[model samples]
Target: MQKFFAVVAFAAAFLTAWTAAPDRAEAAASRIKDLAAIEGVRENQLIGYGLVVGLNGTGDSLNNAPFTKQSLQAMMERMGVNTRGANMRTANVAAVMVTANLPPFATQGTRVDVNVSALGDAKSLQGGTLLVTPLLGADGEAYAIAQGALSVGGFVAKGDAASITRGVPTAARIANGALVEREIAFKLGTMSTVRLALRNPDFTTSRRIAMAINDLLGAPAAEPIAPSTVRLSLPPKFNGNIVDLITDIEQLAVEPDLPAKVVIDEATGIIVMGQDVRVSTVAIAQGNLTVTVTEQPEVSQPNPLSQGETVVVPRTQVTVNDDSKKKLAVVKSTVSLRELVDGLNALGVGPRDLITILQAIKAAGALQAEIEVM
Candidate 1:
């Protein structure tokens, strides 16, 4: 109960401060690195099919997963152990899909983390060990060899009639399990131009970024090419050394311009309003109308020892409560987010009630910000 009130207090305080200071909110600065990313300088996804072994009677059934049996047979044949046409029964191996991300500029001999997930009806992979598997990229070429003991975060314990499982027992991860055997060719310093892609697309923010970069370098080397992209050409001094130029620009701070928006999550009754949210002069009246029904059953019996059958008599009580004492409140025109919040909070309404009130206000065209329901 205390935590709930603390959250309410925090929300009220945040609303108060967010609307009380417009200059500070608008001038909030963030580093360029957090707002944008360099093109062609990102991680690539790698995946492969492999097998997990050493499970104690918790692996995929050979009859159910024919691929696992085929893979096992092929592996045995390579090791001079022919198991073809021979009855081979085993519940200690599982077919799995191995996945990992090849980091940017990853060189040979460097290791990357790999994920192993069961592709069949494997009860658990807690004590399994991934065998020698080749991780492939989108180009259908093997790039890394992944082979390590599985590190499952969850486990499963079962009895005759009860079972308990935590997390995902069929999935596991191996840190630094895959060794890089190939590299994607991309020379950042050799490029004369590069693009900075904004994580959130906005023309105002993109323009601010270009202006900030130009002002810092004292040259018009950066330009806003699109609402979500900024083009940067190498200057004379930074030719063949774009890394230093990017490092210098990334540290420069710029305040991003965002649109005024209010997000409403109906499932969780969460309302988030931007600092720029405004409201026109509007009158809002909020009251609760509660109807409660109570059921009471009484037993009716004979007072004497006469022949009688006991019967149940049903009794119900219904009550209606309409808070007619509450009055309507008026919000002035062009009010800040703090004033709007304060006016709504004064109505003694919860978050769910506030959501309905905000929606009604938006429907009446009194809210100036865009409302997004999620």
Candidate 2:
């Protein structure tokens, strides 16, 4: 009877430890918009083909990049000059594709950064100047113009046979190189209602956001349109300007709801477990195998030097070692994160091995949360 009571006490103690809360603070719940959202504002992509000149002999050759020569000829023709049969020798210029992001509501003369990447076989774009390039938007309309000295964060040098290079040779960037010539039209105050789009859609979080906004501004102001969108009616205070209303609403803090999930990074062998992850009763076993190979050299000497050459013989040795498999551990049902970790750790498995084991367990439907490998 005493032994039975002691066993029961031990089991109770173990259960208590397994169910204990973690030391880390619980993540505060936040609105879907607070966690992730589209702020009704975004940047547009701009692209242009341009020439990078003033290179130190590292530019594309004229024979290899005929497009550069053609572009130069065309530009000269546009300036009321004719170069139909011009024989151009290009050794200090390269053809490049320039790209930039035009920010939302960008006004005229607003300067933006531009990225330039070599489109030809140029060794490097270091110390180059980008000529005036007209940047076009998705609508095929010229929206901005970019022209500045490139800030290539790399260097390249070469001799007759060998070359030394650092950083990326084909890409360079210019700070505040592109000036906005046009802006995208968007009227925030004209709409009777506005929609707030959540970056990450979660039903619980969406509902919380609607409730928080409604509680603050009253029920007649905010309503949930869907799990990912919240439609709000403009109140009298914000009737003239909705931009200020949105700015104020976005600053309101609310707890966010997250789905139970386990994210594993295969490249870095990182395992992240969510709080709500659970495990069913299961058995696990782990072991390792190692193979080793060695080479031995044997020398043979000529006997009395009777026109015989000394030879060497090579001998190869290989061995395989398999470690004893660990004892199978039985995980109980409804196992918490701590219990699951402890159970896996008991098998003396490393992170890489645990990843495969967790995958198998998830496939077997023993892990309750979603498993994601990145």
Clash numbers, per candidate: 0, 5
Q: How far off is residue 228 in model 2, in Å?
A: 2.0
True-vs-predicted CA distance for residue 103, candidate 1, Å: 1.3
Give every collision pair in model 2.
Answer: 29-255, 29-256, 30-254, 30-255, 30-256
Model 2, 1-374: lDDT tens digits are 35433533464465566466473224354434456454466799999999988998888887888898788788779989898887777688899999999998798999999999999888999889999999999999989999999998888878899988899988999999999998888776677678777777778777777787887777567776777887777788776677666777786776666677989887766777776888888888777788999999899888895888889999899999898756778989997666777777667666778889999999999988899988
The best candidate in terms of lDDT: 1
Off by over 4 Å in 1: 1-6, 15-27, 301-311
* Per-model lDDT: 0.91, 0.81
**C-alpha lDDT (0 to 100) for residue 126 of candidate 2:** 84
Q: Give the TM-score of candidate 2.
A: 0.86
Model 1, range 118-154, lDDT digits (tens) per residue?
A: 9989999989999999999999998999999999999
Judged by whole-model lDDT over C-alpha atoms, candidate 2 comes out at 0.81
Tell me each candidate's RMSD, in Å, in order.
Answer: 2.4, 7.8
